[model samples]
Each structure stands twice: as C-alpha cells, then as structure tokens.
Target: MNNNLQLYNTLSRSKEKFEPLNPPNVGMYVCGPTVYGDAHLGHARPAITFDIVFRYLMHLDYKVRYVRNITDVGHLENDADEGEDKIAKKARLEELEPMEVVKHFTDRYHKNMDQLNVLHPSIEPTASGHIIEQIELIKSILDNGYAYESEGSVYFDVKKYSNDYDYGKLSGRKLDDLLENTRTLTGQQEKKNSYDFALWKKTDPKHLMHWPSPWSEGYPGWHLECSAMGAKYLGETFDIHGGGMDLLFPHHESEIAQSNACRGHDPVHYWMHNNMITIDGQKMGKSLNNFITLDEFFSGKHKALDKAYSPMTIRFFILQAHYRSTVDFSNEALHAAEKGMQKLFNTVELIDKLTPSSNSSVDVQHFKDSLYAAMDDDFNTPIAIAQLFELSKIVNQVNDGKETLTASDILFIQNLYSVFVFEILGLISENIKGNDDQLVDQLMGAILSLRQDAKQNKDWATADKIRDELGKINIKVKDTKEGAVWNIE
Candidate 1:
C-alpha cells in the first residue's frame, strides 16, 4: 500500500512525493474556523478536501494524527492584528458573556461539520485552552530577541526572522513585495516593523475574555496559539498542515514565522490548501455579503435555491472539482451533481443483486486502474466518479440481461463499489433504507381487507373496485409461495 503518493504541496508549489516525518504515522494540523458565525458554503471545501486526504492516507495504511484547532479567540473582523476579538464583539451585541458566544457558535460549527459527515480530528485544541503553551512560546521568542515588548503587548520582530527564514515562503512573495503593498492598516504601527504581528496583545479593561498572562492580563495573539499548541502536542515539526487558500499569506505565514522565531526550526512538512467556493467568479466571503450558511442550503431558505439540497449532495458537489480549483455554485451544476450521485448510488446497490453469468463483458482491471490513478493523482474524485459511471453502464446492462458478468467479476465490482463509494467516499443510496416490499404490502393490505368485506356481501363488483384502486399506487398483489406477496412496480 506504500505506493509513492503525489500531493500538490503549497509550500513548494509542485506535486511532491508525500513523505511523512514519521513513516506510517503522520501528524496533520488544519486551521479550523473562528467560531463567531454559522459556517457557510465556503467552509465545506477545505473540510471535505482534507477529510478525503485523511481517509485515503488511512486507506493506504498510514496512522495520521489529524489536529484541527478551534479559534475561540480571534483577531478583529477587519483583519487588524490589534482590533478587538470577533467573538468578544458578538458577546457585547447580545449582552452575554464572551464564553457564551463561543459556546453557541462552537456547537453550531460542530453541527454543521456533522451534517457534512466530515470525520472528527484526533485532537481539536482550542486557543483558549492552551494559554500557557502560547505564553511559553512568546517567552521563548522574547528570550531569543525575535520578539520585543511594547507597553504591555509583545510583537514578533518579522524583520529579524526574515534574515534567516523566508517570511513569505508559502505565499510565494518576498519581503520587498509584501513591504510595498502591505497597506498600513491602523493599530499595527505599534509593532517593530510594518510586517510584524502581535504575539501577545494587552486586553482592555472592558474586554470580556481577559486571562492573566506573563505579558499582562491578556489572551494569546491571533497567530501565536497555532504555533504554540502545535509544537506542544505534535512536535517542533509535523507532517502536514492544511487550510483554505486564504490562510497562505498572513495567517499561515505568520504561524511559520513565529514558530521558527521561537523554536529555531521550521514547523510543517507539507502545506495543503483547498481553493475557495465562488458564487459567480467572486470569492464568497463575509465582506462580499454573498455567503450562504450550511443551514440555508440545507433548508432551502436562500433566495437562489429552488429546493433544499441534502448534505450528501453538497459533499458530492465539492468533491466533483479538484481541491485546488474554485467551483462555481449554481442550480445547474448542483442538479448535475445530484443526478450523477443518485446514478452512482443506484449502481452500487445493483451490484449485490446482480445475477452472475458464465461470461463477462466489462474489463474490471481497466476500471480499477483508472479509478486508482485518479485518486493517487491527488484524490481526483470527479474523474473517479466518471469511471464509476462507466462501470454503472455495465452493471445496468447486466441487470437488463443485455450483458453478462462472471462470478469473479461480480465480486470484484461488489468490493470496489463498497470500498470506494461507501467506505471512502461516504455515499449511501436510498435503495437500502426500508423494507423492499413494504409499500406494496401496506397498499394492498388496505385494498384486500376492503375486498374481503365486498366478498362477504356477495358483491363481485365491489371486490373488483378494491383491486382497481390498488393498481394506482403500483401495488401488484400475487398469490405465490404459500401466501400472497405484494410488490411495487
């Protein structure tokens, strides 16, 4: 199972061989959401993308420690390093404690992820939970002189770290490039350099979520918690770090810079980022005011939605595109995914009930090779799905008796469909849900009970009336195998 798996690492900007720091064991960390609002459609891209990576790695027999963090305390809504916590702002508006806002949104985020069927990570460390670790990291950076105190706050000296490590390695920009256009936002002038970010910020007296720290009565800075908690739990360096493409610049880059500044080593081995979800070529961001929450999509409450889409349909839509390619949301594209997924699930169900023959028509090896190649080439699920459809054609033809499959071929398809569709891809067809003949049984029972009363009155016409009514609901009642069994057409 240890075939050379190729993944497009954002750190190197190429498809490189995925070599975990510890062979057969990988440590992965993704920057989870700053839970202040409901998670939108923009949230599912990176989530399902990494879920596929986790599943496929385990499928290849690797034990992965996937750590995704919760940013309960975050920077300002305007992306200002010195602004008030986003969660804190919500608490003030609702007149509740800051922790209350975190509790509500955190619960909502979990509920949303549950709907997507995204597997829970091995460790979900909260920023507030690891305050000591973050403070310890800032202390180490202070001792190393990579960070300096200003009043009660501490800022990382980005200019100093740039001397050794490339500051914009992940973003593909250099110091001069960022320094030129990195607009001078308010409140960041307190840092040593324009690019320097806060490692610890002194909280105001009115700030609702202040904690005692070495610097002051303050919480960890926006980017410091990831480096500290990651280093504390995973190690100085781990196998993979993943998130949305938006995090490449200041968030992830700052995390790497702060970690290296304190620990004197690079942090992650592989950097994976999933592309954004666009409404109409524009990024569906909060500022754009075009984002749709998962609940809206599920409930069909959005103005653009014709009807509610199931969770599996949304997951399928995201998977249909390459992880790095931006997918446009539209009724047509979504409908296509819905039709395509239903066809796939239906074909999977057909495999078990297919009657094997003495001969076979389809080449199972070719389908297997094609599906594996698509997945091995960075988990290309859309193309894998196309291959599934190709197999589906053969399965349906066999069902129609226009084609044939040998016993061995049938078993191969059964295992392939079960593994790829159910186990790995996590789709289930509605065909497996209830008793197969229950619908017809219920319909015919009512009709036949009425017919018995008609016969008791010696009324042939009334008995015939009940039989005709059963025909409308596709109930076909037949007397066979010791008693009458009914089926729906």
Candidate 2:
C-alpha cells in the first residue's frame, strides 16, 4: 500500500505535493560544501535530508538525476566580493595550495557522508571546472541589461531587475526593504546600488584562485557558480533544488536572480530546505565556532560528548524529528535516540525468528494504512517511526507467543521493513555483527583459549593483548562465569 508523497516547499512556505517537472522523471540539485575545513554535524543536514528525497524518489520508480555541486572556488569569507575567498583564506592559513585545501577537506567530507550512509549523487560538477559556463551566463545577463560592468568587476543591477520581476519572491522580502537594511561597506563605490551583488569579481594580484574573464583576471562571484553549474548539469529548469534553510537568504536568493536573469525562467520546480541543527537553541555554525566535527562526535573526541554514537543512531535521531524542524543536540536527546535505534533494530531482527498462527493478534491492515498515510502527508517520518514502534510491540508480543502472525503477514512485515525503512528512508541496520549468539560463541571460545594458553605461560602481555583486541570488536570476555565467557558489549 503506497501513496504519492508530499513535502514542504520553501518558496511557498507551505507543505505542497511533490510534483516533478517531467512525469516519472526528476532532476535534483543541492548546494554542496565550499570544502575549506572539516565537515561538522551542521554540514550533515542537507546531505542526509536531500539524500532521503533522492532515495524515496527512486523507490517510487522515478528516474531521478541528482546533481550536487562541489564548490571548489568563489565562496567569499564575508558576503562582499571585497572579502577573501574562503578556500584561499584556508590555504594561506595552512600553507597549502587552494586546490590542495579543497581536495583535503572534500575527502574528509566524503568519508563522513559515507559513514552516515548517504548515496553519492549521479553528477557532481565543480565550480572551478565550469568557468566557461559561468562566463557565458554573465555575458547573457550583461546583454539583457540585468548586469553591468564597472572598472574590472561586473555587478547585478537589482534595481533594474526589480522593474520587470518580483526580485524577492522566494524569501518574500521587498526589494526596498532589502536595499534599506542591507549592510554597506567601503566597497560600494563601484556598485550602481548597495543592493547590487557581484557577478564577476576583480581579483587582486595576490589571489591564488583567479581566472581570466572578459571583465578582468578574476574569479566568478560566489553565487554565479551554482547558477552556472546547476544549469549546465540539470538544464535551465530542474525538478528539485535543496539546501540548508540558512542559504535561503542571500545564497539561494542570489542564485534565483542570476539564473532567472540569464535564462528567462525559474531554475527549480520544487525548492526544499532542511532546518538547522541547534545546540541549546543556538545554531551550530562555522562562523560561530560552536560546531563539533562529525569525526569528533563519532569518536567522542569532542569534550561536549559523553560517549560515541553509532552512525545509525545519528541517522535515526535526525529522522525522529521532521527535516524542517530544528533538532537540538543534547546528551539526553542523543541517549534516547541510541536506545530507540537499538530497540527498533532488535525488533526487526526478531521478526524472522517468530512463528505465525492462524490469526494475527495485531491489526495489520490498520497499521499498514496508517503508516502509508503518514508518509503521504509530507513524508511525516516521525509518525511513520511511531508506527514502527507499534509494529515492534506486535513483534515482541508475538515472540513471547502471546500474539501471532500468519506466514503471509510475516512476509508483509519483512517487505515493509525493506522498502519503507531501508530503501525509502535510507535507514538500515549497520551492525556488522550477526544477531546470532552462536557466531559470537565460537569466536569467543577460540579467543579465550588463546588467552588461557598465554596466561599458563605467565605471558601476561599476550593475554592482555587478546582481551584488548576483543574489546575493540565489541566483545566483552570475562575470566569467570565458572570460566571466562563473553557477551556483546
């Protein structure tokens, strides 16, 4: 029992039906990292959030072409072109080349995403590689009178664009309000108006990432990369464009302006944004420096974490709250997620061990229908997970032989687990150790024999090493349960 899905649209600020541009086919784009530093927990938001979207669309039998870009160039430290490129700044700080810094951090980003089990996108183009496309977009905008060149730099004429179209449709802010409250600095002597944004910025002689353009020997503006790269790979119009809610302001907003100005149409059909991950109600961000990297959190290397959480637990925690809701990280919250994940997986594991009866104790029809309804309503994962718990209760009762399921019902339960939990939501049991106790028993008996032999010869070093190695593999071997025995740690 499957139903068509609905999701929140950031442009309209409402939950809407997820209608792809092409029937049974979709093109998706999400803004990727600047790759200047380690990937923190905050960086995992859009990656996992949109990954769920990508996975679910494929489950629906839609041919989805997902294109997430690698922003190897042209992200300014501050909002203005006068500021340094973030990658260039990191390179100078670490005494490395700009591309070297990007590669190093991008590798780390991929590793972290892999740990969280995110599927790689179909096309991942880089900003630096798409310079010709970006230049063409700038030239088109200039010819259309939406952009103008002054000295060596080109700026978008916001005031001129506003005359023809609603410049603030996505963020829902008036152009005059944006112009009024916009931060002004000493760099505006060349801009036609304070609201104008850079299209191509003139680079200083010291800049490492500069490229030759018609206006000057400069890099593309920060927003130009996404507009150019997304259009090149996904075309002038795509099905879905997603990013963190923080990008809704100037970043995504600017992309809308530059791409629409050049192409004469909106780039994305449906816009999705995942809300922020907050730490005690304050946003965990790079500029704020309140972030703990994903590696640090997993290893419990950060001073704030009480213990390391498994990657699956982290995935489940984010899913418990809807993507659009801000999930605050706390020791209590994480502990609850860990407990729930273990409980849920344990139930799924026990399903195969259960035997069915003539009649079922639980109402399978009602349970399945409610679950499908929850998912249909804007992908309400929280409610779907709650239904999973209901299934868990039935499974436990049936395992206790107080309740029963038919053979066909058991197969239905397994199918639901595979399709909805694993494929649709991208949540799977990552526990490499099999659930069977006998496997652990055979391994532990062999290991303890080695320990005993080492102990008999007074080779305490060898015995301790054996124990330490077993501990690393999550097996706790003890010297007495009559003799040394082990349990899963």
Candidate 3:
C-alpha cells in the first residue's frame, strides 16, 4: 500500500504523514449538517472536503468506516446553548412535529448532497436515535468528576477539566482567554464558570424536544452528540476527526475534553478542518443572511444568479481551491468554472474518438505520477486539477493530430481520466434528455441535408435562411472539412 499520504492535522497544527493505527483499517468521523433549513454553499465545503479524504482512503484499499451524524435533536440556535433547539423552533413555526421537521430538512440535505455527487457515508447516525448513548456518555463524564448537575442541567466543568487536561488544545485557546471572552447568555447562572458548556440542557415545559435523563427532562448538548456517536461507532480512539474550522474552538475543543473525561484518553488521532466560504470578503453563512442555498444555485432562482450553474460546476469550483483556503463566491468565478468543467468533459469525450498512432508524444506515467503526488500532499485538489488540465492539453493535442499517441498511451490516458475526473473528483458529464437530444439531432441532420441540397442547386438564400434560424435559437454551427458541427449556447 502507498504509505506517503500526508494530511493537515489541526490538533498538532502541522501536516503529518498519515499512519493509521491499524493498516488498511481507517475510521473517520466528520461533523454533519444540522438540518433546520436548506443547505447553503457554506455547507458544501466540509462535505466535499472530507468526501475527498474518504474517497482517497478507499482508493488506497483502506476499509474506512466513515460516520457522519445528522443533528436532529440538540443543536441550539446561534450555538448559544440558551435558545430553543433549531429543529424545534423550525417545527413550531411550521406547525409540525420536531421529528417531522427533521425528516423534511434531512431529506433536503441528502438530495442536495446527492446532486453534488458526494458519496453516502457508511454510517449515518442521528442524535435522536442515539439518545441512550449520549446520556451514557454524560454519565461517564459525571463519574469522572468532569461534569456537574445544577438546576436540573448538566454542564461540563471546563475549569476542572482544564486542570487535568489542556482544554483548548485543538483550537489553541487558553482557559483564561475563554473565560474572559465568553459571552453572557441567558443560562449563565446555572454554571459555575461562564465558559463551561452544557452536556445536557434542561428544557422548559413548552420546549418541544425533551427526553428523560438523569439530570433532568432535557436534550443533549450540540457537542455531546458528536462525541458520543463517534465513540460509540468508531471506538474511544479513532483515526481521524474533522469538521469546519469555525467548529475548532468550543465544539471540537469540548469534544476533546469530553472524550478524555469519559474514556481517560483522547478520542481522535488526526484532527482536520476545512475553511469556510465567503461572499464579498464576508463569510457566507445562514447567520449572515447573505448565503445562497444549493437549490438556488442549481435553479438560478435567486436574484444574484445570472444563470443556473450545474452541480459539477459547483463541485469543480470547490475543488479548484485547496480545502484549507477560503473559497470566495461570485457569479463570474462560477461561470468560469462551468466553462473549464465543460472543456475538461469535452476532452474526455474526445479521447474515445481519437485514432492511435505508432508513437506516443506524452509521458503518460509522468502525468499519472504528478496527479497522485498532488493528491498525496494533503489532497491538494487544485494542484491535481492543474495536472488534469495539462493532461487535457495533451489529449487535445493528440486529438487535433498536432501530436501522436500509441494504443497503450490511449488506454492509459482513458483510465487516468476515468479514475481522477469521474471517480475521485466526483465529476460526471451532465446528462441531456435522450428523447430531446435525439430529436434535435434528427432535426439538425434534416436541416443540414436540405442546406446541402440548396447549396448544390446554388440556392444561397434558402441555405442562409436555415443557418439564420438555427442562430436565433443560440445554436452556433460551424463548417469543418469533415462536416458541419453545432453546439447550443
């Protein structure tokens, strides 16, 4: 197996060679979406980012049990831990049950992810389904004396946990800084320290989502579900844990503390985080109210979009940048990505049509090696994409008869494009409707045949009329030595 894979470990603040605890057995857990609304562009980053990691690991012949949880139970509004549960609030507003709201948005999230071609995780556990596990985890933490109950709510003693283990190791936050900078929320009176987070939040009588726990009738905290579910599925210690960079501070930090307090050890070996997406140099998030939903991008229904962008265009745009770098959103950038994606797909389509020569002009092995090298370096997809573009150039050159490729070279290039472009990158050609495409082909063939007859008879006016009619529909027709070619604009 290839052992040169290196990834950025947020825990250590450095890039380290990936050495799994057990060879060919990798366990990874990424924080999944909190399903309260339509998933926006900001949500796609971590999904695609960890997806690349998941794909590459499996490609390397690793048995990866990837776990991504659906937040159906306990995530609060604004991460404040005081407001109503996000799903419950939505449910109340929509006049539906809490689980009904969860089902609606969870289905929407899955649909959007499917459109993006992201693979479904091996295990997708919901917090509501694992309430027993979460309560057990909280019990373990309490037994370790890292948590305490006050006013029917259990809060993690960040001050006490910090005394035994470094509380802010993952996010590089100090306990002093957190204590000083922590905002005053409504429920601050119940905790000993301002920075101490809730393990279980006691719900009010009107709160829709509540369960019977040792502390009170309440739900688990946002951070506790991930810690509990991950440990329950991936064991106390796993290979990797990942989420957005924004989650590094209290969410992941608290996870680290809770896992240590419960199991007497760290939960994850490598910690990874993907940066956020921005719009106009400002973070594009639902809280910002400037975010565009994935559905809006696909349908071009928003006021900001000039045209609908295909799912592959969005995926390619995200992959064009390193996962750790911020991807700024703009219509112009997306349009450029659409063109580039189309060009790459066109080259791949042309590959099968090219006739082989006696000699090869491109070094196929060197190209493949460079692609793998880019992926090996922290899954540097932008560098890998650049390599693919170079290979596309070679394919174009050979197709245009400007260069040459032997039969072996043709097969290697085909396989290379198949694996990287389709499998790893998760890009696929957009499917045109079969009946519509066939109808257009038949009509174009008939029209061109009539034009040929008209030109043969020196009927220039008739041929010009046919060409002008097609042009009006945004279809450009070009005459080549082989025949006439056309494309829809």
Estimate every model's Cα lDDT from 0 to 1. Answer: 0.82, 0.84, 0.89
Per-prediction TM-score to the true structure, in the order listed: 0.89, 0.90, 0.95
User: Clashing residue pairs, candidate 1?
Assistant: none
Residue 256 displacement in candidate 2 (angstroms): 1.6
lDDT of 2 by residue, 365-389 (tens): 6777787777777777889999888
**Ordered list by TM-score, greatest first:** 3, 2, 1
lDDT by residue for model 1 (71-101), tens: 8886666753455777887788898888888
lDDT for each residue of candidate 3 in 1-489, tens digit (9 for 90 to 100)? 666899999988899999998878999999999888899999999999999999999988999999999988845677545567777877888899999888989999999999999999999999999889999999999999999999999999988888889888888888787777877687899899999889988888667899999888988887988899998899889999989999998889989999999988999999999999999998889878999999999999999899998888999999999999999999999989999998898788779988999998767779888988899999999999998898899888987899999999999989999999988888888734223678789888888988889978999899888888989986667676567766675
Error of 1 at 460 (Å): 20
Number of clashing pairs per prediction, in order: 0, 0, 0
RMSD vs true structure, all candidates: 4.8, 4.9, 2.2
Please name the candidate that would achieve the greatest TM-score relative to the true structure. Answer: 3
Worst 10 residues of 2 by lDDT: 480-489
Comparing 1 and 2 by lDDT, which wins? 2
The residue pairs found clashing in candidate 2 are: none
For residue 324, give model 3's deviation from the true position in Å: 0.3
